[model samples]
Target: MDSFLSALKISLWVATSSTLLVALFGLALAFVLARCNFRGKNIIDAVVTIPMVLPPTVVGYYLMVLLGREGIVGAPLYQLTGWSFLFTWQGAVIAAFIVSLPLMVRVARSAIESVDEDLIRVSYSLGKSKWETFVHVILPLARSGIMAGVVLAFARGLGEFGATLMIAGNIPGRTSTLSLSIYSAFQAGDDTRAGQLAWVLTGISVFVVYLAGKLSRSRWM
Candidate 1:
């Protein structure tokens, strides 16, 4: 139980912080995506969502290639900071955040697009700056949708498996998250540990589904 609790807490921490970062980046991207026109908007959209459509292992492999100490970006990044983002808790967070980013972006973009154009026009006519319009008129109206997106992102991040494994490996009490820990338990022929972890994950899944349903219902209302 203590092991379970420790893994759970660490997993939640990774999920929460990763989701926050994903939401922040996704929101910024969605804001521009919702309001601006550019030549590569479609390209950008596809790129942002590619992770969702790709197999988890494929994404993980890609992350491993790109983030490994000998890889392109990883080499310089490691040299500059003496930081190893490949096999650490931070790597797990990076994996989770990358995997969950699409969820937040898709939801936030949809929400921002749903905002009444007339309200934006009115604000513009009133000589309000774009930032002011976003702050006063757009954000408040879209908060619920964004919040739902955030929750979904966090849940998805918490459930991340393949990408995390490739990047962080399965080091108990360090890089291992709940999903990876569960996987390790099964691989080690420890059915009891796996079963316990499975129940915990199941509960988390059920709660996230319920929360998402509530958010959707409220949106309809």
Candidate 2:
């Protein structure tokens, strides 16, 4: 019971944190992609989208190469601050953020793109700056879709398993999230525990999906 609770807590924390990051950066990236056309834009979009289609293990491998102690990014950071994300909850958050980012970006981009260009032009005609137009007009118009993207990203983060396991390992009360806990229990032949955890995760995922669908169909403006 304690382990279950710990896993639940960790999973929620990781998912929430990753989702917040996804919402901020994903929205910005989506806006840029929607409003701008630059050289290599397609390449950037493809890179962002690739993780969604790649196997989770492959993504994990990529993360490991980039974040391992001797890795290009990790080595310099470790030498400077003596901090590493390996075998830590922070690592889990990174894994979740990367894997879930595409969902947020894709959905938010579509939403921003769907906003009426006439409305944007009118805002500009009124001497509104691009920043002001985005904050006031664009965001309000795209609220529903952006919210849907957030929900989906949270769901994806909550269920992240392979990449998290590879980077964070399964340290109880530390990095062991619900999905990782399920894997641990099953590996230990604890069918009962695994089933319970699975059901809990399934229920949460179902609720998130339903909410996202509802938000996608809703329009406040």
Candidate 3:
């Protein structure tokens, strides 16, 4: 019981920080998808969104293969700084980020797609640079969508389990987040502990979606 309580705060911290970065990257990608024209854009969009439909375990395994100490990408990353990612809290965050990324990109793309094209054209005609138009014109209009994406990403990150397990493992007081904690309790036949963690996860997921709704709604009035 005390152990479970002890781990809850750690779970929150991992989820919060990881979701922040995931949403940032996702929003950036969404903007590129929404407004940019280039060859193979549709293909790029499909590739980015593939994870949303794939099994979380598969994603975790892929992340592990790339992020492992001896794996191609992971080897170079670790060698460059002697820092390891496997089974760490940061690794858990990476798993959560991947799991939530598709949703974030989707919402952000929707947000940017919903913007008025004429306004962008007007801005261009007025001699505003692309970066300036993005900052002053496009982003302001897409704020609600981006906020919605962030909330969704956070909610998704909160519920991450399979990938986090595969990549981060279930080490408590380290990488065991709320969902991982619940799974641990269940696996150990501690139904009571699992139930409590379940409630916590559910409550947090609901709150995050509610926050998303509020942010989207506030933009209208």
Candidate 4:
């Protein structure tokens, strides 16, 4: 019971943190991709989408290569501060963020693109700067889609398993999320515990999807 609660707590924390990041960066990238054209734009879009298609283990392996103590990015940081992401909850957050980011970007980009160009042009003709127009016009118009993306991203983060297992490992009371805990319980022949955890995950996922549908159908303004 105690372990179940702990795993639930960790899962919520990781999912919330990763979802906030996904919302922020995903909206920005979506806006940029929808509104701007430049060299290597397609390359950037493809790179962002890669995680969604690649196996989670492959994604985790790539993260390990980049963030391991002896790795290119990790080596310099480790030498300076002796800190590492390996086997930490923070590493789980990173894993969730990477796996869920593409969903946010894709949905939000489609939303932004669907906004009427005439409305944008009218905003511009009314003496609004591009930033002002985006703030006032584009965001409100795209709110439903963006909110749906956020909900999906949160659900994805909450359920992330493979990359999280590879990077964060399954250290009880530390990096073990609900998904990892479920796996551990099953491995230990604790069928009841695993069932309880699975039920909790299923309930949360259903609520998130319901909320997404509601947001997508209703307009705030």
Candidate 5:
């Protein structure tokens, strides 16, 4: 019971933090991609979407290269701040964020692109600043897709395993999330515990997906 609760707590913490982080930054990036056409935009878009298609282990490897102690970025940052994400809850969050970010960006970008250009033009003609127009015009119209993407990102974060395990080792009560815990339980021949956790995870996923469908339908209705 205690183990189950701890796994649940860690999963919720990592999922929630990753979801929030992805949503904020993802939406902003979506807006940029939707409205702008800078040089190498396609390359930037491709890079952002790579994790969605890449194997989890590959993504983990890339993350380790950039964030590990010997990594170029990680080496300097750790030396300067004495902070390291490896094998920590923050590492789990980073893993979740990277894997789920593409969903948020793609969905939000589609929504923003679908917004009626006429409305945007009208807003600009009214002397509204571009930022003001976006806040008042684009956001309201795209809220449903943004919300759906947020839900999807959260769900993706909750189910993350391979990348998370790479960065944050299975440390019970610290980084052993529900997905990791399930793997550990099965590996130890604790089939009963593994089954129980799997069912619980499945139920949560169903609930979130159902809630997302409702939110989407309500927005359209």
Candidate 6:
């Protein structure tokens, strides 16, 4: 029971943290892709979205190569800050963030793109700066879709398994999330516990998806 609670807590923490992180950076990327014109824009979009198409284990392998102790980014950062993301809760967060980021970026980009250009032109004519127009005009219009994306990302993070297990490991109480817990339970022949956890995760995921659908409809209608 304690282990279950710990897994629950870890899953919630990782999901929420990753969702917030996704929102912060995802929205920015979406905005840039929707509103700006630049060379290699299509390439950047494709690269940012590769994870959505790749298998989770592949993403995890890349993460391990990038953040392992002797890895290029990991080595320098570890040497300077004495921190490494491998096999840690922070690594779980990163894994969840990476896995869920594409959905957030795609949804937010569509929302931003759908905004009426006339409104932006009016804002500009009214002496509004780009940042101000974005904050006041674009955000309000895009709020519902952005929120839906955030909820979907959070759901995806909560259910992240393959990548998280590879990158974060199944360390009980530290990095073990609900999905990992379910897998561990099944491996240990605890079918009842696995079923219970699976049901709980399913319920939460369904609720989250329902909310996202509702928000999407409300925004589009």
Q: lDDT of all the models against the reference?
A: 0.87, 0.96, 0.84, 0.93, 0.93, 0.94
Q: What is the TM-score of each candidate against the true structure?
A: 0.94, 0.98, 0.93, 0.98, 0.97, 0.97
User: How does model 5 score by TM-score?
Assistant: 0.97
> Mind sharing the TM-score for model 2?
0.98
TM-score, predicted candidate 3 vs. hidden true structure:
0.93
Badly placed stretches (over 4 Å) of model 5 are: none
Tens digit per residue, CA lDDT, model 2, 13-104? 99999999999999999999999999999999999999899999899888888998888798888899999989999999999999999999
In model 4, the runs with Cα more than 4 Å from the true position are none
Query: Model 2 residue 215 lDDT?
Result: 99
Per-residue lDDT for 162 in model 4? 91
Task: Give the alpha carbon lDDT tens digit for every residue of 1-221 in model 6.
Answer: 89989999999999999999999999999999999999999999998899999999999999988998888799899999998998899999999999999999999899899889999999999999999999999998988899899999999999999999988999999999999999999999999999999999999999999999998777542
lDDT of 4 by residue, 1-221 (tens): 78888999999999999999999999999999999999999999999999999999999999899887877787888899989888999999999999999999999999899899999999999999999999999999999999999999999999999999988899999989999999999999999989999999999999998998898787765
RMSD of 5: 1.2
Give residue 203's lDDT in candidate 2 (0 to 100): 100
Better of 2 and 3 by TM-score: 2
lDDT of 1 at 87: 76
Error of 5 at 219 (Å): 2.5
lDDT of 1: 0.87
Cα deviation of 59, candidate 6, in Å: 0.3
On the 0 to 100 scale, the lDDT of residue 104 in model 2 is 99
What would the per-residue lDDT of candidate 1 be over residues 56-131, giving only the tens digit for each residue? 8888888877888876778888899887777788888989998999999988888889889999999999999999
lDDT of 5: 0.93
**TM-score of structure candidate 6:** 0.97
